[model samples]
Target: MILILGGTTEGRIAASIVDEGEKTFYYSTKGNEQEIALKHGVRLAGALDKKELIRFCREKEIRLIIDAAHPFAKELHDTVYYAADELNTPVIRYERIYPKLDTDVDGIFQHLDYDGVMSSLREDKVRRLLTLTGVKSIAKLKPYWKEKGVQCYCRILDRDSSRELALKEEFPEENLVYDTPDESLDELLKRLRPEAVLIKESGISGGFLEKTAIIRQNKIPIYLVNRPQLKPSARTVDGEYGLRATIDEFLPQFFPLHTGISTGTCATAAARFAYAKILSPSPYVFIDKERIPVILPGGETIPVQIHSFSGSFSLRRIEATVSVRKNGGSDPDVTHGMLISATVSIEWDHTKEMRLLKEGELPEIIFHAGEGVGTVTLPGLGLEVGGPAINATPRKMIRENFEAVIERACVPIYSTPIHVTISVEGGKEIAARTFNPRLGIEGGISIIGTSGIVRPFSSEAFVNAIRKEMEVAQATGAPRIVINSGAKSERMVRNQYPDLPPQAFVHYGNFIGETIQIASELGIERVTLGVMIGKAVKLAEGHLDTHSKQVTMNREFLATLAHEAGCSDETVSAITQLTLARELWTLLTPSELTAFTSLLISRCAQHCQPLLPNGELTVLLISEEGVIYG
Candidate 1:
């Protein structure tokens, strides 16, 4: 659970961001203000003191705190820090972006603290002063003004509390200016005609710029009070996106939402459990005697369950097997609920064991493709031709897990040779639905996982894959790279560039922006983007993410492109009436098709040039019939 101390724009955005899966509570100090509507799982509550706040966090099981309150709310900020310290919880401060002061202007005084404001006022000996700071600090300034006999005017919110604060401070009714922040202070400034303006350094959202500009235009001296200095230990972010990123770091677990452990993670857990069982008495090495933690590639540790385990040991041989059910969550994957198993067998090898012991090294751990597991038969994949279809990430995971088990148990690995076989139940049938058949991974699905954890429908994972593939291509000393939308386009591109190595072709999967940006960053000399008409139209309109859910094909946009291509009104109308982008081919004549294709390719190139600033880009539009729009 998370708690957000919010009253400003940043607070509202933070609430929305953390409110998705976590139970978030938004705290506000103002009671009379209108309540802002929030999404599900976010509850709005009134303010609490330090002790009360600590009690609330404990009662609610809050583990993270996001402080997005006003910068001037020193009391509230202090309370949040104290409560977080007492609860031993993490706190992220969403600080506002302060506007740059115009130091070039004459007769402007800026102070880092409130004392500087008082010093400047005392030095100036100003008789009439106008304060744009809120009513909360009026009491502090009243003493100084009264001692100096300076007639002070203050602009505050038009609320009963604000008026009462001024009245109790003995500020005259005529000198009290009651208005909201957005309301212009022109009337009050003109009526008072003060020699200077006193204000706090509220950020842009707090009308700091507007107040400064108005005071400067009136030729009034400005005294700006800097915000209080916060603790250096507090993590501070300046924007809504930064706040979201901070919150994600604090609470890294994916919950009731659509997320899953990768197949590689499942295989690693099974292999590790099986290997651990061979060394330990129990089948699992429980963390704190509760659960087993499988560390993913990204350094995130997730608890996995061992569904079943069995082992047998003899005089010269040891055998163990473990199974873990794959959980794909909401990802549209074929192997969602399948069981993945790993069997480990070790035999005494005297000759090899003697050589290994002489060198003080462990014996080799061999891997095998068991039943329902595929074998690589292609040259493009980063594996031996006859090796198991487990990719490099999963292979590394398995080796790491095995080594971890050996190190934890101090097993005598130098005396034995081990072989581990990884298998998936019903994976061969599932491979037919994936790209394994076309990729030449015969018989079964590949044991593939890059991050070891699947964020359902994760665009980040797709974009990351494109980046990794581009990096691999760049590492191959390939001067040119081919970027495609999917496997079909990649195959078509391969036919076009037959001589180029397979590493030179990458499937972007609706991540055109990321692909181009990565290509430019990798300093590739040339890039060819092969896309279908549906995605091409979206790209032409500057929608880099061409996913249907992210951006729909704009019929009017297509019609406009057609009109620009010198099509007739009737033809344009027919194109607009068409439902799918591919339907336009049937509606257009040969000349119109040429014109439309030319315009689309031109538009795509125009939009892609900025992303490929240092590289050359070529756009290829493929039709429904596999015809290239050259």
Candidate 2:
């Protein structure tokens, strides 16, 4: 949630920006000003003290505070800073843009503070003064003006409260000039015919420029009190766009969140940094080579950070290790916070033991799976029977980044043999939560990433994985392909098809239509789709993309189907009112279950027919009790 401290024009603009979303509160001191309108969730609160402000933030669960108050509101600024510090909340200041003053002008003098303005007035010996500063400081200036024998005329807001305050301060009623929105400052100045004009340097919205122009036109000297210098407690922005950008960066978890670099990209960056450190004498080496911007398969070129590095040099060998922490952005990835490290070692030998490469070829780059790195024991996966679990894309990334750094360092490409071992901390424990064990990847998690970037809830990544799996399965000369919604459904289907190879099982995630279409394009003779009850219902309704955000189960459609299957009105109503699709199985009788499953299978097969025109498509609905229908 956001809290906006507002009153000025910039504050109103900030309020408008936050109004686009819920969970925001707009605040102001003056109740007489125009009230801001917002959506249902946004609240508008009046003035608050330091203690009340902190309590308000705590009660509202405010994550961010925007200080967009008037620049001259020094006490309010201090209070906001104190309250925000107590709450440990991030604050952004929307500062007003002050106009640049021309000190070179004939009779314009700028004073740093109120004292300076008074000192300047004393030296000038002005007979009459017209002050545009607000009524709050009228008492402070009354002494100096009275001592100088200057008749002062003060302009303040035309409000009963303002007049009462001025009168209470002992300021003469005859000299007090009440200002309305429609009043002209030039006419007032002409009527008073003061010797000099004194005004505070409020920003453009405060009419500082207009007052100065009128003073100059009347050939009267103007003394301006410069704005107060208050140190901000948080980051500050001047304009509306800057405020929006800052808000986006601060609270990206809310909406329009940005994607982050993948673990594969982190490993690649670590490999490059490690290789560069071995070649350079300094503690750190910065590579400045341009090679296609190191794009991830997802087509995003994100920046990477080298978290830590260490190196050592021994007889005829140089070794360096670097670590990079993976950032999953807003995605709930298992490896989001894992530290992926790479150790690069270069060995040189003048004897016959050294391996030589052909001309124009690089050194022999060998990859090793260190601790926390998995090894492939399965035949279906696109890896050697016994090799490192690093997938093809990450391997390519590591090789390319290492080669690029070596080339820039001007190292001998053909002489030294480079060995890179990639590892992840606590990877084995992390792998337990994934499908690595089921896929026959033993020891630890696989260093697998097709795109070096991981987008939050990315459908493209899942679709791409399905396509890769299909290609691998087709490469194995498999006549039939198995597609499942998730790991659970895949396991159930695998048990049913014990003879099918591991490569033949593809996890389509939510892209059922895409999987069938890709399988048909790959020339597979048969396709089997394994679905759980939750997704089976959506598929039966012809939803190819079964993500809840894309499509929802239509209870009316289910009722119609149940009625056509010869269920009574009461049974049909129960089916329609059911919250979960799985609940229907418990409510339905044996005959109803048979009729419903048959109808659902026929509808699903009809939808799959267009995607797999050349191949035969089959649907298998499975649950914990085993295959419900096939």
Task: Give me the candidate number with maximum TM-score.
Answer: 1
Candidate 1 C-alpha lDDT tens digits along 111-208: 88666787778888877898888887688786667774788888888888789888898878788887755556876788789988888888876777
Query: What is the Å distance of residue 521 in model 1 from its true position?
Result: 42
Structure candidate 1, residue pairs in collision: none
- Tell me which residue pairs clash in candidate 2: none
Q: Top model by lDDT, which number?
A: 1
The TM-scores, one per candidate, come to: 0.46, 0.42
Residue 130: error of model 2 in Å? Answer: 0.9
C-alpha lDDT of residue 89 in model 2: 91
lDDT of 1: 0.75
Tens digit of per-residue lDDT, candidate 2, span 1-630: 888888677776676556434344545544546444444225465678899889988998888989888887888888888998898999998876666565676367988888888888888787799888888878778777666467988998887878898888888889999787566888887799998988887877677778788889999998888887766558777654456656867886443433566677877878877877776657455444311224344322334566777787878778888788877764557788889999999876757465444433666678888878898886545577588888778888876666556656764555566898989999988888776776678888888765565544545654655665577566556667888865456766888777765567777767888889898887888998888877878888889988655777788998998998888788998876655577777778889989888888888888888898887888888864666587
Q: On a 0 to 1 TM-score scale, where does candidate 2 land against the true structure?
A: 0.42
